[model samples]
Target: MNARRCDDLRLTGSGGANRVMEAELKRLVMRSAFDVRVPNPKREGDETLLYPFDARVAWVAACYHRTSSRISWDLCSSAAVRLEPLFEDLVPVLSSDDRLPGGPELRFSVEVGAASDFEASPLQLRGVVKNAIVEALASRGVTADIDSEAPDVVFIVRRAGTPEARRTVVGIDLGGSSRHRRGARVATGLAPLRETLAAQLIMLSRWDARTEPLVDPMTGSATIPIEAAGLAVGAAIRHPSELPWRRLAAFEGLPGETPDLFPGTAAKIVALDADGECIKAMVGNLRAAGLTGAAFDQSIVIGQQDVRRLTPERIEALLPEVRDMRPGVFCINPPYGVRIGGERGEHELLDLYDDMGRALARFSGWRAACFVANPKFVYAFGHHPTMTKPASNANLRGHFLTFQF
Candidate 1:
């Protein structure tokens, strides 16, 4: 394929959660005082976003964005299926820019897109791409090794465009690991929500982490609560220095190795779970995320409580600081009943939803946001949602519903 230069960086976020990512990106840009432009997706339903290539902007995005899964330098795009032409343009850039690893030995891997239609299988396509990259690097006097199990760097090769006019895009992964693996979740419960998805729910709810309180009534694994706590404190999702971008030549001379986090405020966050085991997991996750001790206790309160019994009075009792405060937010991810054994389990889950609805009604002047895969939740709750946003939890299609209590 003949290589075409791309002057933008690419960020891929979770499907059905692009809106949240866009909003978060804009906020980050504003806080960082960067003049980068945030543009809409090229096409509807496309999860990839493009931004003008600025080393600082890319670094900030790689470090602070809670919604992006992968950040990459848009190396080249081409209509040719062959790897030679693509790397012809890519190799010169890597070699001159010092993008290749400088060590005595280098390890790398190639990831191909599932939807990429090629004459070869996915495995074969990966092999071809790897060979092309290695040959290109070797020609530039850089020795590299193929290490799929563990690699210092990874390259993403994907096919885009229609079948009639297919195109191939190549990028170097700026972060070696997926951003969603925030390095805090040491333990998880059944149907644990993804950390990025949890952040999206919080953003979508418009929960003011500073003035308003946030509660997760069914805090399985405490993903929602942990994310809320981080947001309240203006914590970077992950440290900037941990990313691989710093080691690359393309990002050389960029300042702010230590990202400037948003100014945080004292927040009253509560996490509750009926299952003792889940509560234990939550504590472990909290500790892993460095949210412990008396100071943390003042801001975040955790306990075991059934959702049905979760009244505003119960919350006030847990932390008296919010007794006279303004209306807060209720962010929950309740059971979806897919894993529950059978008809009896489904009925029990529905009943639980009914009880949850009744308990939520007691919290006057509050807002509740829930993501559930089951449509029965609305009927059981007996309330029309103020907003119904289409979202997905893993492979299951779900809706994020908001209720005014």
Candidate 2:
């Protein structure tokens, strides 16, 4: 027999920072299918459903225009074209000529780099980038006739690092050396990340109802951690506030659902930053945004606290505080290699990952959700975990690979 041949897709190199993750996922899928207990069975003729190859998977690319973080979104967008030939086979389940079901389009979402014009964002950038994606699809012969809602599969690309093949993405999405009347910034502003992170908590709450006390150990700008805890719980960002409630109710260019406008039982969230300036500004932003529950404080625990050093006794002490007296996993966003922090900070981060892995092995039943730019860290995470499908983050080029234990 031909060894029951199965298909596999491989994306070699960093392709910015995220290419390695994409390749690993391809490996993960192939392994899953080949090692599966039951082979994927073809539909029997009379089973009643016809699969179409007409609708294509849209491979989307996004690079954020600017942010507090360092990612050259523009360079990522420019480099994404290289992925055309490489990513063509991302999904191999359907035939080349298979017709799409009701739709023949597959689209990808890419954020514009901050270096690009932000002024126009209030006007035309969205359309322009959409056009770029359509053309990118054309390069693959997947969508010469692309349109809105036409794609069956959407691929989003964000470049973050120097891939082995595409060395060092030189472009960035931050502002130019000089400021302009119409600044080049990603206009949806910080509101979206805030809403989405909060919504993530909502979804999680639905999944595991018993899990109450939400926590984000390292609350930078206090946005993510606060949102995860719920606007009602107790919110805190790095900056200070003068007019908290008004800022929360203020009109953001992009509107989002704020669950805790009067989040009654606000989380006792503590926003911590090593920089006093950041802490001050965060307090101001929180007040300006009218956030009610945020508290600013300096924290050595956020990124600096080593997981290896956390003893079972220490963890047990806080166990009651985490899930309202129940044991819960610690969710975190570890540093990827870049900026002053991230992986570029010598090998301090790599050692951190190793330590975390060993700690996780000790806490086998603790369900943890860790987002890493490099997915292989999961292997280093000490214990085997169920991995989720990955997504791309603009600030960092690599895909956001999630591991759940």
Candidate 3:
């Protein structure tokens, strides 16, 4: 049994990706004996701390940042910031935790956050702290190397209070690279959805492969189908062992492999797109994800068909492979004028959505989970979503609409 102190492990993600992140974490905690706490309303930093984390739970999430660091905030002169105390605070935690990388040469970077009124240059302050940290480690006979680009560790310094109560807070980044880059997405379109967001959308759809299959009509770059394929196969997509922190001697016994989430049979998924290029990309993505061979062909059907032109018969024709599977939900991110460089007129887009809605209406018992920036266009479907939730991507605000047929 691992006996190290259960420090709060922080996870970070894209700006609006935290809700699904929290929900995903909760599912993992429930599956295991590990203690996981998702803040009621996650804080502002796009980072959530999973307290008393079990290393085994890494399979469910691959956050933008993960860290066990000392948080010190202040409102003061940037030059007044000291580093010795911060590293001193981290040593105990890093040294005790066997999952982190140890170093004779430690690459690190510093991010400075200042109050609106502060005068000191963050660049200058970073230099000061960096020098102090190097000297501080040297004093203890611990050698260190600093690499600003792709640093093994990242330190964040933020201003907290007014000049009268001046202070700056610092935190070390634990997870080296964003866990969202799960390696499957090699090809992309003009506006490919982020993989993490795609996975989150799939989970939120609540489509079960056992009883119901998933359909992505707009499978741009095939992110949704690829992610679903990963989940269905119980493939350990996120390889935490590749993280720089894994080199730390302190993290001596951390598991290098992520266990499969699903075992036995794979899930049924249909990937469709109007662009033949996207269909090709989907196949390539699935291949990259090791979703090839006879089983993959039996489970996933990739084709090029315009969703607007889809009829129940045509849909069946296009997905004859999964025709008997009875698709449960249409989980998709439909095109918007602003994204993907809309080449068509506004009326054309509305008509397309209307046609899609009309075509889908025939399913009678299927469901829909559509993401769109403009809620007004939803009316074209002639049916309102049973529920709507807010979501964002690429800095564009949007809503996730769920409809029951």
**Clashes per prediction?**
1, 70, 19
Best by TM-score: 1
lDDT of model 2 at position 377: 65
Q: For candidate 2, lDDT tens digit of each residue in 130-185?
A: 45445544444545333334322222223222334221111211111111111111
Instruction: State every prediction's TM-score relative to the real structure.
Output: 0.91, 0.38, 0.76
| Candidate 1 lDDT, 312-399, residue by residue in tens | 7788888886657788999999999888898899899989989998988888888988888898999998778998888777778898
Residues 116-185 of candidate 3: C-alpha lDDT, one tens digit per residue: 3434466665665566556645555557677877777665555543346544444444444444566777
Model 2 scores a TM of 0.38
1 versus 2: better lDDT goes to: 1
The better-scoring model by lDDT among 2 and 3 is: 3
lDDT of 2: 0.33
- How accurate locally, in lDDT, is each candidate? 0.76, 0.33, 0.60
TM-score pick, better of 1 and 2: 1
